[model samples]
Target chain A: MSATLEKGVNAFREVMDAPIASFFNSCVHCGLCADACLFHTETGDPKYTPIYKLEPLKKIWKQEYTLLGKLASMVGLSQPVTDAELEEWSPLVYDSCTLCGRCTVMCPVGNDITYMVRKMREGMAASGHAPAGVIEATRKTIEQGSPMGILPKTFLAQVRDQSEETGIEIPVDQAGADYLVIMSSMEIMGYPEFLGSLARIFKQAGVSWTVSSEAFEATNSGIQIGVSDIARQIVMRIVDAAEKLGVKYVISPECGHAYTALRWDGPNLIGRPYKFGVVHVLELLDQLHKAGRLKTEGKTDEPLTLHDPCQIVRRGGVVAEPRNLLNMVASDFREMEDCGSYNWCCGGGGGVSANHRAEELRFKSFQVKKRQIEGTGVGLMVTACANCRNVLEEGLEHYHMDTKMIGITELVAEYLKEDKPA
Target chain B: MSHMDLLIWARGTGLQLALGVFVAGMVLRFFEIYSLGRKPDLSTPRPGKAWAGWKTIVSRSFPHPSMAKRTYPTVVLGYIFHIGFFVALLFFAPHIRLFRETAGFGWPALPTPLVDAMALAAIIGLLMTLGYRLYHPVKRFLSNFDDYLAWTLTLLPLLTGYMAFHHLLLPYTLMLAVHILSVELLLVFLPFTKLVHVGTIFVSRWYNGDMLGHKGARL
Candidate 1:
């Protein structure tokens, strides 16, 4: 059936597995998650509390899963989740939450509030309660290869441009490469320098890396929309391309959620392990540096700080790599308070960047990042995630702060040691 | 029923029924939750997962530094009340005597003055906690009937026990019976209410720590 109330209820029932069951059971109604949430903190609205956002999902779990809840429901004592309720909750589920997962980490009971929110969005999306912008982005990701509707020709053309600009060969679909590198559309369109940087680094390191024309887009809109089926299909394209080329590793681009979708949730979403390893680009760069292949001659003189992308650093375990890589070239590197795994989200993650409806709220939530950067007192900001970079740039500009944002890989590539004569 | 008869009933039959419900309900609830069976994590684990998981059970007992700084009152009061309650429940002389009489086991207890101070502190801590729950916007918003019921049930035993010990509210037998019955009420409600957190917190924290630790995240 269509995205009806019954479909949303049924979806909640279907997804109510053990973690959700225990998470609901274990919640102590401690409002610590509210203080942990940037939305509630920034907006001063209790409704933005992470656990409160899952009221509908909790209702279904209680009614269907718990003995006392079951008894209450059978006796007609408990109120069922209504369409009106879902409608009211749609904004809380989609607009307010970036799914940055601060609350999950901060939850005293370890309730995994972000996981529940992600699961709750499954019902929200099915019931057509998901925001129109996210739904459209998902549609585009399914129809087009990228959420931004960049076709293969567009991606290839960008690759060609990057190759010409770098004066280095950018291989496309070369079989038996050591790495199959993927790029998010944001990088392709907004920051082509990432591809150029990768090309330069791979050249100097003498590494075999090729871009897959078939699966060049790394960002998964299905994940942003909270639809696992579509996310699986999106990830399969990369898995198929990487498998076909027999690459040793599939390099996730400088995108936060893209790294998460590929490195963390990809195997689970596809229900099987990949034929190749999944490594975030920063991780691969750090590996190359450790192997003594990636050599840089000098460091940037400007004072700089890093904004760790929540998904890549916090959720994906690439915490040390960025620091390792950043230390190589950033001599004046200073850390922001609450950096690394505890870093605040740039507020544009989890498809908020794509959802135009969330623009105002997104900017409001960026105040957290704004204060963080302000605390750092550094003009130059180096980050690993392109989305964080973009969001940070916007926040910087919004507040008229002259913080120059650059990709960490590009910074490292700029300082690549010159090739010596043979 | 006469007060003596009521005291006898509360001490014998009522205690048995409440303990039976408490133990059986808790076991069943725990079983249902644990047996739901988490899906096997297929992702590769980082090093020291077991250590991290166990460490998290202890570590989460303290708030994260950032959270602690922001919510010091709640955290401090929470520990005070929990420590006070456990000490009063297990280490107080009267409670130890009750346990020895009922279960044929006893342990060295704190001196009467020490236990008395701890009981008073716990009662004050619980009262502050309840007042915070009622007044604090976020806590108040998050609280439900379960939270208030759990709070009241937990507090009643300590309050009634204190009254019985000091012989303030009624005759010693009646007050003791009230204390026993309040404790029984808590036992019966323990499995059904937020009081279940006493048992489930470790499991939740361990799972969370294990999951995050597998990803190399420090909980």
Candidate 2:
């Protein structure tokens, strides 16, 4: 066994132990998945076909991975896999595909191609087949608790700018607050204004809230890099912090993947659903609108469109909330026909946007987005996810597509009614 | 087209066309897949876990979002083409009754109208999907001659089967000869080309699901 392989064969055995794997024991590929892939779409590469992408795992499963799989493997007819084969598969698996779940969405039978890629990544990561960039990122996240390795004080320093700019008096662990706001590391580094906006929005709405310095970040770069223990450790750190603080609810900042890591999987990974409710900033904003606690005074007339971050809209189902907020602030909103949970990735999700080598793949993947933007005939774009903002800004710069990028919260903050504190 | 004369003519001419399409198509597709082998993506996953990585294939095959998150159409439509297609190839009265002379047991089949409708739908679906393979910019760009050949081979058999069954323009024996020849071609090509995807897709999907679900990645 490779040193990077899971210490025992037990991890492989545990998969069949679950009926989900057994349930998956059945399939006859019609190549329906090819139609749904970003890589296939962007590159017109059939090799990126979702069905073809699964050959490595299939060969192993058929031969040594499962009971029936082994019997099939023994037959001369069984699929085969080799280390050299893995070396070749790395780019197709990592650089070409984004694990964005578009294929999963389009799959006729609900096959999750993204997940398959994730497992392939795990196998690769475990076997030390990970790309140099991914390995480095995973190592950093494992040690630093965030991909960037920004210290807790540095994180606070980033937020301090928000406090100074808005004079919103952002509180940290003010005991007995009704809400605990979870923020992502992206916000800490790039958009401190968002933290100020969250404070301003909440204070105007007459809500009590506190931020956690420990577990301050909601982003799990480990998940992005395909490191499970690193991912779990990140989630557990936040949940432990949430419990220690004893807050009523955890309202996530305007970040897409982080929201999923916390609300959707955090519960299960932490061995239980969180005691407090978990939701995104858009959800909170939506609640404020429904409760008549939020008010907007201005609108941007620039022709604009919305880009739904894949994780937030597609995976987390936080689609309309962002649209509803954007529409409230702007009169001219043209949705890319494929907008909503089905919107294509900005080529930034799944950590691809972060890897230096993946820049070209990122460019190809963003072609769909570029077409969407061009088709919209819009001048400005709004999205809830920071990673989407990073990618769109970077992609536009690279592609020389002239467009403006704005966050939903920052937009909402601009439109907030000027009034006395509620 | 006299009774015996038509049968003999069909056996000779029709079988030749069917075999030519099937064998040539398979050979062309095998080469296409061989070209695709140049792709490094196929070789990315680790080796020697004692089983095939089937996580992604199984999960995506059911409850897809584009299908309105529906399961029935995928299940019913998928099984009919795969299960029914194979059964018809291996067990239809003409194939099975004849095969019994060599190897086999009889199985129930649909009524004439139903079988006719199924064969027709399968042919149309098969061809339409094939045409789509050629037309779709992504599929077209990714396609090799092998891809085209694979589509041709899979569709022709279904088409010939339909024509043979319909027998509006051709005699039954003539059509049946074509159908059987096409089936034999498909059987021979089963391990090569994208046709193999029809088998690989399931295991691939399951592996995908297992990987994502394990990592808490949204599937």
Candidate 3:
């Protein structure tokens, strides 16, 4: 009856479907996913192979779903997945994996290893084997409205501060606005300038946008912790607020998984389409740029390269928009190798940043990004995700590199053109 | 049974048994998978081209440029064995004559020497594939009993056929009968082993490509 081994087994059976069945059936055991993973590449450990991490899930599929497996288990030929096995796999599933989709992309038979990892995490979390740090973050998100424990008053306080600093009235609870903007807790706490920049740019563009006090946080810790029920509740808050305000769009902040949870997984989690469209902030800026509404006065002449966030560009389909926005305000923008849909992950994504146990492994995996940025030989790196920026900043500092990380919105805001009197 | 009787059983009764199990097992497995069905995606898609799913099935046949260098050996050897097997199976004169006799139709086949050369190259390619699996640490670790079993099943028919053609180590009738029996063994195991990938690869690649394609991400 407890949320232990039985619950984990039941959850796997519930999640098993056509795609999962076929993926397991079709795997050729080529081990190509190992080379596709950063953890395996950097650590040279075979256990970190992306497909190998799904052994528990695969065993469940075989034992309960396949004919031969059923017969074998009836006679006790196959060992049942025990609590100890789940315990052993905890580090492999959470600590060593970032769900980066690199292996999914590179799989010869197209197994979508990252998708399976996300599903496997459901079993891990249900079995009480989830990392302690992620459990705390999910608890905070459910109770405090933000994974970092930022409450409504704290979010409003940051709103007030941004309004005072920008000398513009930042709208709150404004019904029937053109856009309802949501900020990640990372942005609210680490980079309040992102909100200030959005306010300034919206004021100049004459776009109607407001932040809802009820649902301003965009990041979903339920997704990070791999629980759909909690993720559904978190997404429901935004859906309710946006529908009540009758907004035209909900702008996802420059947080990678936040955008994914809202724009991609949100509707599916809720089991219906939202009245308001969900758009990434960069996509909105790119749309305004295309409409001739966004005007910039100057561009940075320093040679800079973009660090494509894994979820935003690769997983979120915001690939072209970032480049389109960066081209507008950066005069010397350069492309990094393997940029756009095939970019390496920041290694702190998919709840790894929230799990304190994964810190050392996260740092080890960041070596790939380090080598990528060092290859560009640029002192300035522009990224669209606040989480990617923070992770990149930590990695850069850890390696004693002085590459400055800036959000694309903040970069655009610095070059915003002033409104002229007609 | 006498040796001649054994050859007769393998050619007639054994072939029927193997073919029946292979077809029936494959259909049942395919049905089990397809019957699970996909859940509807309620999320709205970004504005882009539709049918990215169908496009992905074709596109994934070639490796993405970024991944090609790292996966060159597997891709190369995979193409070699697959193409070689097809050419040796479908285009050899003897196989065509068998088809013409049984199925009442046949296409023109390659010259006997050309088919012989292709079979030799394919056998070498499969050996190299096995060698790569043994030598590479990652592949060696990932390999299981099922993988080796599938490899042996696939390699046996080709090896025995080549031996019968060259008349190596045994009389022609004995080698030919062994080749037929080896092929029947492969037919029986095809649906049950990792060799099922031959049918499931397209299904998996299509599903993956379509899912990502709907999101407008390049495969």
Candidate 4:
């Protein structure tokens, strides 16, 4: 079946639990969350306030769960959450909100407004109110192996090209490798240099890793679209590939939500612990650096800044690893005002980048990030997430700014110390 | 009823009923929230950040440093309001006596003038809060009947308590009764409205902090 309002309402009921109940109950309409959200702050639009985006979900919670709400419904004192409301809220739920979690941390009552937005998307997606672009992306993710509809052949071709370019054999489906490396479609299509960078770094570190033909796509449109089952299908591919190959760890590429989906949410989505571990590329690189296996010749002389991907640093908890690795490669790295876990979003996360309708608002909200970059006065900006890199590049280009961008992995690879221990 | 009878009722049956509803309603609301229960996080948690949940419960009381300028009315004024309200509620001589009689123990009360100042500060903070709510676009847009109702119920107790203490609004017996009645109104509605946050905020903080902290993100 496609979708129905009943299904949407049922999905809302299914997702509702203690944390959400507490969050909804604890909200005092202080509106401080708006200040924490770039969408509201940049646009000065009250509708973009974080918690208000969940009005439909909150209504369902109130109508179905609360005693007063039940009585109100019975007496017709309160209107039920209608299909039209969900339809109207599509842009707010999917387009404007980026699941950045800035509002989650800033809520005075600790409401976790971003958490509710993630949950609210479940209803929105099930109700068929998800934006066309996102729905298409999810469809492509399920039908093809990737959201961008890049096939395994295309991925292997890119791997082969990178292998030739780097003079390193990019292993595919190699059994008994120490790590099963994954890549998001953005890195595959937009920045295939990442594969070359990873190959060089892993080779230098003496790491045995392979790209799985079945699970090379790291970004999960299912998670972006808020469907657990689809997310599970996407994650299970990696788990299966890892288990089949007996890889000890799975490397999440420089994609923000991809790391979160694999590291934190994968087991829960699949309802079982993975046989192998999940590590972000930065975490693995930092480990190699600390172990003295990974070394860089010299730091970049230019003053540069790092943009912390919300999912990778804040939500994924790979906070120190980026800084640890960046310290080795960047000499004059300046910190943003709220860098590391409290960093502002690139306005392109949580399927907003995938949604065509969100482009205008997304660009408008990029003002906060632009100010952050300008404040640092850094000509070069480094980030670990490919999605952030893409979004930040778009923002910079749209504003006609000349700030150069690089992935931390690629930046580190440029300075890789090639000589082996004698 | 005469003012004396009203005062007697407010102290005796009215206080008892309010206290009863407050306790029972809170218990029920807490059940409504906690009983829903969350799923266990099947993801491997990062070690060494176990206390982050409790830490955030206390830490979240302060505004994020970068956001402090923008959140002055909510955070700074919010602190003033909460501190003043709590001092008046918990430390005033009559309140302490009442607590001692009911709970079998009481701390030494604050100086009357200090408690009075705090209450005055809280009243001012609350008025400022009202002004902020009206003026701030986001808050104004988000505010509903329940928000304003909770605000009124909260302010009435503080306003009426101050009036009763000063014997300014009405005859002393009538004002005290009204004060007690205002508090009783707050008590009865506390569990149903956003005022329930007084209890649920801790739960919210814990859930948020624990989830993030489990992933090794300090909230």
Clashes of each: 0, 56, 1, 0
> Interface RMSD (Å), each candidate?
1.4, 11.5, 1.2, 0.8
What's the lDDT for residue A24 in model 4? 93
Task: Enumerate the candidates' DockQ scores in order.
Answer: 0.66, 0.09, 0.74, 0.88
lDDT tens digits, residues A269-356, model 2? 5565676777678888999988999988888888899988877777665667888898899989899966775678787777776677
**Where is model 2 chain A poorest over a 10-residue stretch in terms of lDDT?**
A14-23
Error of 2 at A291 (Å): 0.8
Candidate 2: where is the Cα deviation over 4 Å?
A1-29, A65-69, A75-80, A420-422, B1-219
Q: What TM-score between 0 and 1 does chain B of candidate 1 receive?
A: 0.95
TM-score of chain B of each: 0.95, 0.59, 0.92, 0.97
Instruction: Report the poorest 10 consecutive residues by lDDT, candidate 3 chain A.
Output: A1-10
Worst 10 residues of 1 chain B by lDDT: B38-47
| Clash pairs (backbone) in predicted model 3 | B53-B210
lDDT at residue A294 of model 2 (Cα atoms): 90
Q: For candidate 3, lDDT tens digit of each residue in A1-422?
A: 24789898878887888888888989988888887788988888888988999999999988877787898899998999999999999999998887778888788787888888888888988998999999999999998999999999999999999999999999999999989999998999999999999999999888999999999999998987789999999999999999999999999999999988998889989999999898889989998988999999888899999998888888777789999888898888888888898888888888998889999888888888888988888899999989888888898888898899899999999999988889
TM-score of each: 0.97, 0.72, 0.97, 0.99
Give the distance in Å from residue A294's predicted Cα in candidate 2 to where it truly belongs: 1.2
Runs in model 3 lying further than 4 Å from the true structure:
B1-5, B47-50
Ranking by DockQ: 4, 3, 1, 2
User: RMSD of candidate 2 to the true fold?
Assistant: 9.9
Tens digits of lDDT, candidate 4, A1-422:
58899999999999999999999999999888899999998999999999999999999889888888898999998888889999999999999888999999899899888888888888888988999999899899989989999999999999999999999999888999999989998999999999999999988999998988888999999988988889999999889889999999999999999988999889999999999998889999999998999989988889999999999988888899989888898889899888988899999998899999999999999999999999999899999888888989999999999999999899999999988678
What lDDT is obtained when candidate 4 is compared to the true structure? 0.91
